[model samples]
Target: MSYTPLLQQLIEALRCLPGVGPKSAQRMTFHLLERDPEGALRLAKALTEAVERVGRCDSCRTLSEAPLCPLCASQRRDRRLLCVVETPADVLAVEQSGAYAGLYFVLGGHLSPLDGIGPEEIGVDALLARAREGVEEVILATNPTVEGEATAHYIGELLREQGVGVSRIAHGVPLGGELEYVDGSTLTRALAGRKPI
Candidate 1:
């Protein structure tokens, strides 16, 4: 038998999430309806509020409720250094590391020519403008994917012309990883990026 119209609609909507297939969507729908109607309502309200209030930060392109995100508004962060990343999620990951004290420029996404995403679409001009405003150094923290590397190289060249110091985040073996399990490329990068102890 088919689900009631409302239930079927809910199940279909759940499938819009990444990695959520038909079976998972159906299970989520049933679980929410049977055990957590209140939780479901809360989730709906949160989603609605986020969709209504959240938007890109004026300066950095990260998600924010106001013109500037909290990080952009902070005075304690170093203004002379900027870390360029692929997403708001990457910003969060860097923040969790507590190793970066500089400001950030979120690209929203990497360059994907096949998807029609280019420097303009990802706001590279905005980033360049921001860099021109006394940013002395730019750290490219884009992911290690091909698109990410291309985006970083493009930005690096742009910044180099402006006399801004540009650096890429070193990619290599993870801290708890064994060298035997590390891929050859990662091993090569680790060797190339070696530092004096």
Candidate 2:
């Protein structure tokens, strides 16, 4: 049996979300209609408001509700140290770790030539401009993927030409992971980045 036009529309709209297929979207539509219309309304309102108000930070390119995000506005963060990340989510992850106190420059995405993403698409020139304005060190916090590595290397070269120090975040076996279960590349990186006791 076919769903009503309105219900089908809702299901189709819900499927626009990442990882949500037809079954998941239909489930969500039914759940909202039958169990929680109020919650669904709230979700819709929040999504509309966020879409209207949220924009990229002028300096860092991270999502923000204002011209500058709270982190960018704060004086406590180290201006000399900048962390380059592939996404705003990465900035949040690094912040949650409590190990970094630097400002951030979100690339919005990594380098993926096959997918048509390039230095300009990721805002590398803007990042370089930011680096020129008194930034002493840049820590590349991009993912360990090939695209992320290429993005970091490209940015490292740009920063080097500008006389700024650049470093990549270490990639290795996870903490508490046994060596036997670790992948070859990760194990190799872990050994390469090993520090003196």
Candidate 3:
């Protein structure tokens, strides 16, 4: 049995999403085709809108539909304190914890030499540049992974040279747990117990 060319193409494209395997892609295709045609159309429209309208925040580099993200635009957040994270999801995690009332800097990714991803590729230069502009403290909130550690150390050194204080978030976070997966209470405690780098 063969799927129509359009269905096969859609399934193949869906498989490109993170953690979506071929079987899952096929299941999703069939589910969408059989059960929820309107839902599928809505999903397609939302995906296209997100891809076309959303972009990186100019100040913090987090994903945004406007020129700046809500955090960047908010006067309530402490501009002097900056939390450097690997992605927008990290920022959201920290935000949900309600423990951090400071601004954020999203690196977008970690530095992985094996993957040919370096500092420049992940917006490290932009972060360093931001650090030079009277930033008081920078909390490294990157993931608890090897590449994430490398990125944190690199930024710490750069910020230190710029006369800005640098700190790394506590490793009390569970091993292999992404910030997005950790509960808000645990994340709050981690932020509260952060140590200097």
Candidate 4:
């Protein structure tokens, strides 16, 4: 059983999406072509519009259409504090927590040397350039992965040289998880990072 050339192309295109395997792509292609072509057109139009309009914010590098993101442009935010994250999604996660009211600098990715990704690829220089611009403290909110830790350390050292206060986000067990159920590595970190009551 073979699909037409156009249908095959569509399936391949859909496979490019994250987590969309060949079977998932085939199912999506059929659903779009057989059940809802109109919906497919809407998806295509919206994706095209977003691709054309969305770009990096000049100040923070998060996804935005304007020169500066709303957080960077707002006077209400604490300009003295900056949070460095690895991606736009991380910025959204921090925003949803509602605990941080500072500006952000998105690295867009972690540093992976074997992949040929380095400070230059992740815009470390750009972030360093903004360190002296009234940002007294930089809180590293990178993920808890090894690469994320390396990135945070690298950036922290650079910022310290610029006379900026740098701090790494704490990592340990989850708020709701029981101590017995926690993994040894997490428990070890939790114990190591224990705070005074």
Worst 10-residue lDDT window, candidate 3: 168-177
**lDDT, candidate 1, at 75:** 95
lDDT of 4 at 17: 99
Q: Look at candidate 1 and tell me the lDDT of residue 134.
A: 91
List model 3 lDDT by residue over 16-93, tens digit each. 889999899999999999999999999999999999999989999999999999889988888889999998999999
TM-score of each: 0.96, 0.96, 0.82, 0.94
The residue ranges of model 3 lying beyond 4 angstroms of the native Cα positions read: 173-197
Worst 10 residues of 2 by lDDT: 145-154
Question: Which ten contiguous residues of candidate 4 have the minimum total lDDT?
Answer: 125-134
In terms of lDDT, model 3 sits at 0.90
Please tell me which model should have the higher TM-score, number 3 or number 4.
4
lDDT of candidate 2?
0.94
Per-prediction backbone clash count? 0, 0, 0, 0
Point out the higher-scoring one by lDDT: 1 or 2.
1
Off by over 4 Å in 4: none
User: What value of lDDT does candidate 4 attain over all alpha carbons?
Assistant: 0.93
User: Quick one: how many clashes does candidate 3 have?
Assistant: 0
